[model samples]
Target: MTDSTIWWVLAGLVVGAELLTGTFYLLMVSAGLIGAAIAAHLGVSLPFQIAVAALLGGGLSVALRFYRKAAAAKNPLSKTDGNLDVGARVMVDAWATDGTAQVKYRGANWVAMPVTGETPTPGMHQIEEVVGSRLLIKKL
Candidate 1:
């Protein structure tokens, strides 16, 4: 197939991978492939086409990373519903330091932790945040 055809197929593959994974990685690369296609169509050589694709893709990925970071930094909890129990109350059943901790929240046993200014004891605890299936808790 022609260079353009190959580039188009690559772009399609990138988009497909992005769709399947719901990640921005391949999507950005696919956009770079589109740019490469443009260059190829403009009579650029294979090396130039490949270089452009790599440069554009890498540049976009880095820029997007920084952009996302900046945006997130600007609004540290703008989109979260605070689902991590940022400021909720619960009851601690055990202490979880470097591993796992159990707690009771809404009559449900959940993993929790003690906040920096509070202590972790049985009974009531205020959930400061959630740490990936575990909760960062403090005394209520």
Candidate 2:
């Protein structure tokens, strides 16, 4: 097969792997491979083709990392809602002196704590966030 065709095949394989892994970083590297394929189609030297591919892949990967970090910072509690616990209302029978208690939630006992400095009374509470196995709660 021709050099350009080989590069295109490599790019396709990388893209397929990215789909299976659910990592966008692999797709970024595939972009570099496509760039190298384009350089080969243009009859560029092997070293230049490799350089184009490497630069494109590395740059895109770094940009994607920054974007993911920024998105996480903007929505820190996004994943908590998917647990079927966060935002669910629960009945707090009692609370400890430190504003913590064990409450029944989603058919399971969960350690709950107040989100703010104000102490929560024994009544209806809303699950504001889930941190690990614990719940950050607020008065309903």
Candidate 3:
């Protein structure tokens, strides 16, 4: 029907897609659609309205993604087990070679590596840092 109506419909689609994707990217597009609709309602030109929407929505999405990446890179445990077993002591189940080893912690076997020093032997060890599924460890 009308341009504004089309924008609203597109916004609804964006929100729906975002829900399915479980990411905030589409949500930003929906927000852009809302901006476009608002601009349209304000009697703005079609091109200007679309531009505003694209800039607002796309800009926000990119900013959010950048922030998330920066935060995650700053803190590796931002998404993983940060509080659980972090800075806790565990037992080593293997040795180190080229900064990689295996350790047993909390009744689970985890591959560990020394980030600064030699690899811990099978027994008591301390969890130093965790990057992804690997744990950087030190002898306790």
Candidate 4:
């Protein structure tokens, strides 16, 4: 019946939906709804309550989106937890003219590229990252 009660109900519904769909975005909105409920209980005007809800929810959603994007950008295709080849060492006999090298690792020949900011030279290298079948190697 009270404005705060209504806001609390909305927040509860958003949380329930998030649980069913497993969508993280809804939790941001729920946080906003809870903020609005607090504002209502403080005897704030309806307009101010609405603004509080919108600002909290929208800001949180945008923040979460950007956070996810940044995290994805940082994650390479060769995940440290999933791939054992990362950090393994191999010998490079020679580097081709194109700045790539073919090295025998794990009983097979693999194409490798020098890690960024490192010069490509023939010697022992460590697998820093793996993108598909290509290996990113850095001088050890």
Candidate 5:
């Protein structure tokens, strides 16, 4: 087969693999293959075709990495309860002198501490954050 035909076939395979893996990296490489195919169709030399493909794929991958990093930094994942326990109601039977109490949560006793609003009395409270084995709570 011709070089351009091979490049197009390779690009199609990479794109198909990317679909199965759900990753954009393979798609970036596929874009490079497509660029190489275009160069080959334009009668470019074999080395120039390879260079075009490598530059397009590698540049896209690096650019995507930086974009992903910046996006993650802009919207960081919150580790507080991971949205599983936070905002859940917990019954605080009593509070100790230090504003901490033993509360049953998720079928187990957990150390609960007040982090916002009024100090928790013997009543229901909302879990604001889960710090280690302790639950940071606030008045409901």
Candidate 6:
């Protein structure tokens, strides 16, 4: 098959794989492969086409990583985006001396603690992040 056609096919496969895996990084790589296909269509040398793919794929992945990090920094709890309990309310009956509480969340006992720079008080709290078995909670 022609070089440009091959590149386009590869890009399509990468896109399909990204869909199955649900990872954003693979989409970035697919974009790069598309760039390489364009270069091939323009009659660029094989080495130059490869360079274009590597540069676009790697550069886009790195950029996406940085962007995600920045977004997490702006909102610390953003890292827990995949957790279903995040932002869900739980009842804290009491707080212990160590600033943790035996709270009932999701119909079970959970060890809940406060987020950074907050005093743990007994009342209603929201799940901020789940680290292991412990729930980092925010007083609401």
The TM-score of predicted model 4 comes to 0.57
Candidate 1 clashes between residue pairs 3 or more apart in a chain or in different chains: 113-137, 114-137, 115-137
Per-model TM against the reference: 0.62, 0.69, 0.64, 0.57, 0.72, 0.62
Off by over 4 Å in 4: 78-140
* Tens-digit lDDT string for candidate 4 (1-140): 99999999999999999999999999999999999999999999999999999999999999999999999789855457668899999999999999999999999999999989989988999998889899999999
Instruction: Residues 1-140, candidate 2: write the lDDT tens digits.
Output: 88899899999999999989998899999999999999999999999999999999999999999999999888876747457777789888999887789999768899999887757789898888888888988888
lDDT of 5 by residue, 68-107 (tens): 9999888876765246888899999889998899999889
Residue pairs with colliding backbones in model 6 are: none
Q: Relative to the unseen true structure, what is the C-alpha lDDT of residue 58 in candidate 4, on a scale of 0 to 100? A: 91
Per-candidate RMSD, Å: 6.0, 3.8, 5.1, 5.8, 3.7, 5.2
Distance from true position, residue 117, model 5, in Å? 14
Which pairs of residues collide in model 4?
none
Tell me the spans in candidate 1 whose CA falls farther than 4 Å from its real position.
78-81, 88-140
The TM-score-based order of candidates, best leading, equals 5, 2, 3, 1, 6, 4
Best by lDDT: 4
Which has the higher lDDT value, candidate number 1 or candidate number 6?
Answer: 6
Better of 5 and 6 by lDDT: 6
Please count the clashing residue pairs in each candidate, in the order shown: 3, 0, 0, 0, 0, 0
Which portions of model 5 show Cα errors greater than 4 Å? 81-84, 88-91, 95-120, 131-135
Clashing pairs in 2: none
Index of the highest-TM-score prediction? 5
Question: Where does the lowest 10-residue lDDT sum fall in candidate 1?
Answer: 78-87
Q: Point out where model 3 deviates above 4 Å.
A: 78-87, 91-123, 127-137
